[model samples]
Target: MSTGFDREQGEFARGARAAVVYPDLGGSSRDADARLEETAGLALAIGIQVEDRLAFRLRQPKPGTLIGSGQVETLAEAVRDQELQLVVFDASLSAVQQRNLEGALGCKVIDRTGLILEIFGERARTAEGRLQVELAHLDYQAGRLVRSWTHLERQRGGFGFLGGPGETQIEADRRLIRDRMARLRKDLEQVSRTRSLHRERRQRAPWPVIALVGYTNAGKSTLFNRLTGSDVMAENLLFATLDPTLRQIALPGIDKAILSDTVGFVSELPTQLVAAFKATLEEVITADLLIHVRDVSHPDSEAQRDDVEAVLADIGVAETTPRIEAWNKIDLLDEERRAALSAETAQRDGVMAVSAATGQGIEALRTMMAQRLTAGHRRFVVRLDPSDGAGAAWLHQHGEVLDHWVEDDAAFYEIRMAAQDHDRFLARQDR
Candidate 1:
């Protein structure tokens, strides 16, 4: 099967044998074994049958082919022996390196970026999601056009009706890609503007937004469903949820909140995707609270946490934003481990251990969310004419009304709310 289009079908079409290679460049922070395992999981998520997995310690990377000549020959032999249909590299590959490897291996080859793009292309459900994926795909392809099409080098003369010789096929194709990327960017900008307006409306309503973010398959979707009582696509596979999902829920002391389940983050996530999905991730940026879920049972949980934080920092999430760590999947751990983790969480300031599957520690989590939302909020006591039902209802909806009583034909309310909301209320009262 060809690499480009057929690779997109890897997740659904079965029986495609593949080999995975992870080049362990020195001085990397991530564990090579964990990286290899994650890469294998990524391949399996797309339905590729992994026949061989190899990790090479590379002292220096070859220019033409990423791997050395001996490694290439050995891999070639194994590919022929195993009759592998594809080879997937765990690192980004230059177009020339990709072409050279494909020539040597005599089979399809794809790198981490390409594999991720394929998964995104398949998983994106909404129109905006598809547009973003297509835009990223086009941008990635634009850089490799010359390497992809050999016939692009052939000269083409203009018709007699036209003035001069026409642009070469490669130039024409690149121009077309550029134009398409421009249009897609324009469309995405419009979508972003609409999302901003919605965010503004939410701000006026002033229900706190809580966004869930974590590594792929860390049970973010499961936790989201448990918290919101909604069935999102939560599975063991990587990237099961692509499009951001939002639902309204009631929190302790808080009347309502908008809970958002966002696309999972992965290590070395394609730059193209990061740029393309900025509009979608704005939900995370504007959230009053961020719930960072972690698979505590996983061996590389700490490393995964670092990766997620790096991505968040890269996306410009302010360091001052309030965030909580949800140590999910505690059920998978042994009793002693669970007890230790629970104790550790208790000692921590903003961490909670919970199993989304069994409703463990969920109440504590909710309480913590409520506390974080109301932290540093201002308390106000206001007296209103009993006949002014609108003002009473506004206070009830916009703030946490701690107590209310009727006295002297007036409604007296004791409320606690964010300073911003308090200001907004005062502004509205003035008008």
Candidate 2:
């Protein structure tokens, strides 16, 4: 038997042989380093095992290679030596740059957008999600109409006799993709309508909805699963949970309210992705409360927070929507930093620090959410006739009755409730 696998492996090797490259045009070296690491993480998520990385401090991007001629030659040699099957660029690349890089390196080249699209294509679970990913992919490939259609030379239809169609294979493929996109759009619209109807029904229920949103892999899903006792997919990978999962969280005081975990936002999330996944993100827009979770231990946590907020604003969730900020992943922080963060943000009403993984400060978060839910309630002390079962039933259904004392002639009650429900309570008592 052979001792170990050789570096020169088959094209269909189980592990990907990949490399990362970035053009250092501007920004701090620390930022560039972080981006390279993040890109490597993204590549790994897309089933690519990054074998090596190359960074060039180019003052400006070359139109063809993005890393200049000299750097391209060096990178090509490295790719040959390492036997890389694919190359990933940290920054977004134009169609020309992508084609040139692939030709020069003699391997498949992917930019940040393409890599992200590939991950989405692989991770999408629901029919709507799959359709959305396909739409994005078609839109992306449409722009790069280069060599992908070179295999349609001898294709024919029917019983394998001869060529049949007037249109080329490329044209026919484009038409088929367009038709599928049209059908997907119609289906997505129907899904949207159904979701709206479900939302309307939930409005009539006695629950306030709280949505958790943050950057990818920022522990939003973990917090969601912890709070709701759900077994939703929570992994260390990006976009682990694409479909929004809503679960009923029983807060201590307010026994039943919906807590929805929405898809994470990212910096420069493809515009096509936003357009296609609007159905999934509707949870964020319709939420009564938005919980913004941030990874406090991250070096760029504040910037990530701003990115999430920007996406929220774009989706119309930033206009007067009540939002609470959760400084998550506190378990990763040291004592000094934790104390510093706590002291800095302590006075803010909507800000709280917690660890989703270790279940730290979760009870306080639940209490805070309950307090927000009950903020508008007015304490009501009402005296009703003891035999009036109808009034008691109305109160029980419409509002939370704190306590009541049974008397011979009437019932003494203390209630904390919504103003609208309080009005209804008075009307039923009068009746």
Q: Candidate 1: which pairs clash?
A: 11-46
Question: Candidate 1, residues 250-298: lDDT per residue as tens digits?
Answer: 9887878999999999999999999999999999988989999999999
Candidate 1 weakest lDDT stretch, 10 residues: 155-164
TM-score of each: 0.91, 0.85
Local distance difference test values of all predictions, in order: 0.83, 0.76
* Model 1 lDDT, residue 402, Cα: 89
Model 1 misplaced stretches (Cα beyond 4 Å): 1-14, 146-172
lDDT of 2 by residue, 363-431 (tens): 999888877777788888888888878778667655668999987777988888888777766775566
